[model samples]
Target: MQQREEKQLESALDSLIQRVNDLKSSIAAMIFKVENEYETLNWPQFLDNFALLSGHLTSLSKLLNHDKCPPLRNLTVLPLNLSPERDEQLAQLTEGRVTTFAHDLVPDYLRTKLEPMAESKMLHFEQKAATVTYENAQKQVAAYQKVVSNIWDIVSKTREEWEVESSSRGNTQQHSSVSDTHLLVTAIGMGKGLKPNPNANGAPGQPTGGMMVPPQGRPGSAGQGPIPPSTQTMTMNKTPSTIKTNIKSATQIHPYNR
Candidate 1:
């Protein structure tokens, strides 16, 4: 009975192995198509590969659940006693001084217990990273908005100042122009009755109206006695006629009097 049971178990295990190999082959083919033949692969070929893989997986699942199958458990790995030549070849391939399957070749982590808190720590780190990135993005946006607002304010203030300065300058110019015009009008009005001095010396080539008159006295008398009343009256009356005669002669000689 023990031998028969072993045979049945072996058959079941063989079937499971065959199904797993089929699944592995189907996966490898799919990976090859994706990696190298993706451009040439059609929907039908992809669906066929998927269906084959799914069927193999279903078979493997059924076999694993079968009564004849043993319970899944950790199995001890025992190193094969390879020949010396084969051991040397494996050592050369791995670039190690010892055999590939030596007890010391196992990693320390595989021999130690897994820490339950490691997964939680990794999750916490990822969450913190995501939060930091989001906060940085928000800060950048706020800074950008502030800079834009400042630029807008500066532009608006500059425009307002320019307008105000331009208006003030225009008003000042207008006031100056009006004041100048008023001064010009006042000068014209005040100078209406004013004339050039006729007694002033004339420029070269111009005639003058002035003339020199002789003093009322004897030609050779320097200290003569006082004249009689009748003589003085006659001299005074004759002076106006003599002065008139000289002015008339000067006017006739001047070029402008013609």
Candidate 2:
């Protein structure tokens, strides 16, 4: 009975390792070209990128399913390059201070132990994920916040243009602030209605209602709504404060191609 179990573990591990190798090659071939590209793109490019990522992840799932067996076969044939000195090298890399105990430490330990170890690892990951509760709506509602954040890459300032304005405030030199360009802008808005006060940092000029103006000189003008931030920006601000959420009726579409 013990011998049979060892054989089963060996076979399973062999299948999994082979499957992982196959998947690595497929993923390399599929993704080697994403770096090369042409002109500007629209949302379709994002969809394409998502599709590509999904494909690779699927390959990963296939690999995981295909190879989830224990290294029971030869048991002597290790997963990585093996030499007399390889064990010491591995221990150094892991910093785990691994030492080879008697393979006979458990009467037939190979047939009885490693499989349960792998199963335990699987359970551990699942329990960790449960702690996050990312899918629970109530937990998500609690996640709403009071402040928002945005990231920016390039900031291009417009050439300063001088102009004179004849307003009730007299002949004051009103430089067209629009000409002074910038890389990015950020602002906040909160209101139960649409009237605007230009002086308010949150106001977006004269708009229909609740308005959000990116601070000072943003890529687009005021009340343009939100722009899907750049990927780098997402990484920089993964956990950000959320404010003025659940106001979907006030959402406006941006005109420029994202």
Candidate 3:
């Protein structure tokens, strides 16, 4: 009797795994639908359905290997995945269209009216599966979706930060270059209006309508005698040399110029 029961349990397990695989395939269609509009994707509904399915699979696997219910290791690499023949058998046993579980062995009358028992067993399996699914299925659909969401968020945020920095750097560089090339005009007093100032420091300005004139000397003009072009050179600043540091910071230029 034990042997028979064992055989039945094994057969049921095989069928369950196969069904789960089919469920996985069906899930692809749902995934496609969700991908189209992920914002409105019914995550709770999807999670519930997926959890129910995984729970069933985990339950079946546990039932098949009931002797080892409390998994010994943190990473229980099922040997079933390593064996293609068993995998094929599992696929065949679970598919409703390809079920080879010999339903004819049971009485035809019992088979004809088994929905209640079948539903009960299904509910039981799903509940068990949910438990096992939580324990065994290392990567749930929820986990997968979370991973994708996190990656997208990271990528978007990184792009935004990079763009902001890039724009700021460009603006800074543009302002620096413009300031370097731009000239500021100041007036220095001179002997006449058109020529160099005999008293001021920089360029002269217009005293009247479209008329340039020498700047007037002040009472406190101590170092204001030359009005030479060289006096204005001290105030004008140049662009710093460290502007291109990032592009070639790591580069090495040998003494031999190699």
Candidate 4:
């Protein structure tokens, strides 16, 4: 039973080492494809490499977590004696002093085992994220306000212009109505042989009640009253020769008769 357990342990270690090596090779291949063959790299091949690396990592994790596997925390590094030739080769490659223990080459901080400060890091991250969110929210609010302000300005300007146009149209219509009324009054006055009173208190060109004046040149009618329809018709029918003879007689005797 002891021998079987030892064999299982050896097999588990070999499988774990093999999985690690596969993962390393996959990572190296992917890095090479990116650095050297980027122009000709195939996406399908890159994805396959990534999948293979993930599989290797999964297998390694399963091996480490298996009941037969020993705890990794209890493992210790064992120093090995290196041949002089190997030591010389390592010294040449590193270009520094060589040591048997790998930890001796690392900085003290890096070599020390550290417990994670999860709570502090999480709090700091939350604060930073909240700050960023607030800044973005403030920016969005300012932008929205600016847009709203611009829209309000446009609406106000449009309303003002509309009001001005409405007023202008109203004034034009009023003026046209007044002109039409004046024309009608003037036509009525002409048809009735009447004229607008010059001394009326109303607006110019408008009629005043009972203040209209009669037209000139009618028999038996004075400037104070309108001519009768019969008199107006008789005056209109008079010949030019008769009017000239009357005018000549009147002019000849006007001064002495007066």
Candidate 5:
């Protein structure tokens, strides 16, 4: 039973170790993929892909519980995104459709109107967001690695402890087996000492200690002389009647159905 339990523990530990390794490898691969994919996309596509990657990082961080890793995007600055209608109006203005169509019709006015959009959608802004996202993801990967390493350390320590325990238990069992063997040998030696001699001139049916042996009789007639066969048969036949009388008396008093 102890050996079976040890095997089960070893299996569980091995399974956990494998899972941790797989998680680590998966996180590393994903980080590499995100870095590679980020390099080729323009700002819009890059931002979208980064958002998806950030979601995955958030989920992985939650699973691994990495407290040191911060949020992927900054929250201190309020978002500068415009409402859909305002965004469409701004787009129309940029293309010189909302108001007038000409050469720099409203330079200062256009700069004022487009400033928030520029800050929200420009290359520098997106790059900054991407940088923060990538940094946090890297931190998450490091944290995940740390978690995996800690788990491996725990498994190693547990395996060492199990080995020590198993060795001690084996030693104990070996000592017990030796003791049992010694006891069996001693018992056999004692039995030999008490063994009766077959060549002794004792009474025909007497035991080695000179105790008179009883003749075979009824079952309850130990130490008695043997009864006649007819009498033994009669005694055996009376037992069933006595049992039936007792059972009837018991049932009348107990009245089981009532």
Candidate 6:
């Protein structure tokens, strides 16, 4: 019975080791494909493929160091190059770690001793797997955040340029409006034909100005007379008492208020 149990244990270890070798081959194939297409592969697709490959590799690692068997850090025929020191190097490069268990290469002959060792290794593997998964996820998240920050930077720069262009356009429009107003004022002063006359229809056959002033009494009319050139000069020359009187009169009788 003891010999039969030992044979069963040996069979289970062989099967587990074979599975580990198969997984390693699969991971190697994936790695080769990724390396070949490193320049041309779509990043998001590659990330997904890499995630699947890593998961399989993780499974293989677990099997190789299974509690029922002795821990093996390096497989003779596997391409993973798995070792505690190498895993640390990988972690530095990929922001990920492939954990390994350190133990004797041969399992104990006694079932009592082997079973307990296996259970302890299993628990440790579970904890390590959880930690590795979380750390890998964090690295991926940070990579995604960097992309987001770059996009936001581009958007911010575009907004700044647009604001600058809009301000420049507004200034140009303001200058154009002032130029048009100045030109209109000059033409009205120099061209006698463009003068405004209030009593245009008073005389038959009398020469009238080109633009007739609109009659008063209409709602919202700008009053009966054109502003004289001397009005600005008179305002500039006003005494303090005169300016105060005008301000008082304007406050008492504003057209908008009335």
lDDT of 1 by residue, 129-166 (tens): 77777779799899999999999999999999999999
Residue range 1-258, candidate 6, lDDT tens digits: 878766766776787767766666767776887889778778787777778767777776776566665433322322333233435554554335333312331233212344876889999988887777777989989999999999999999999999999989887743357767777887767663365566677754344656544433533456744444466467667777687899999988887874
lDDT of model number 6: 0.65
- TM-score of structure candidate 2: 0.24
Model 2 lDDT, full chain set: 0.50
Residue 58 lDDT (model 1): 85
TM-scores for candidates 1 onward, in order: 0.33, 0.24, 0.21, 0.35, 0.24, 0.25
Clashing pairs for predicted structure model 4, backbone only:
none
Tens-digit lDDT string for candidate 5 (1-258) = 878756655665455455555555666665675688666656776566566656665565564444333332332333344232335555564454444323343444434345665766886777876777767989989999999999999999999999999989887743357767877786565543344556457654335542333557555565666565687689889999999999888888895656
Q: Give Cα-based local distance difference scores for all models.
A: 0.72, 0.50, 0.56, 0.71, 0.61, 0.65
Lowest lDDT sum, 10 consecutive residues, model 6, at: 101-110
**CA displacement after TM-score superposition, residue 230 of candidate 3 (Å):** 90
Residue pairs in collision within model 6: 67-118
Q: Which runs in model 6 stand beyond 4 Å of their true positions?
A: 61-258
Which should have the higher lDDT, number 3 or number 4?
4
- State the TM-score for model 4: 0.35
Per-residue lDDT for 172 in model 1?
A: 77
Q: Is 1 or 6 the stronger prediction by TM-score?
A: 1
Candidate 6 steric clashes: 1
Worst ten-residue run, lDDT, model 5? Answer: 70-79
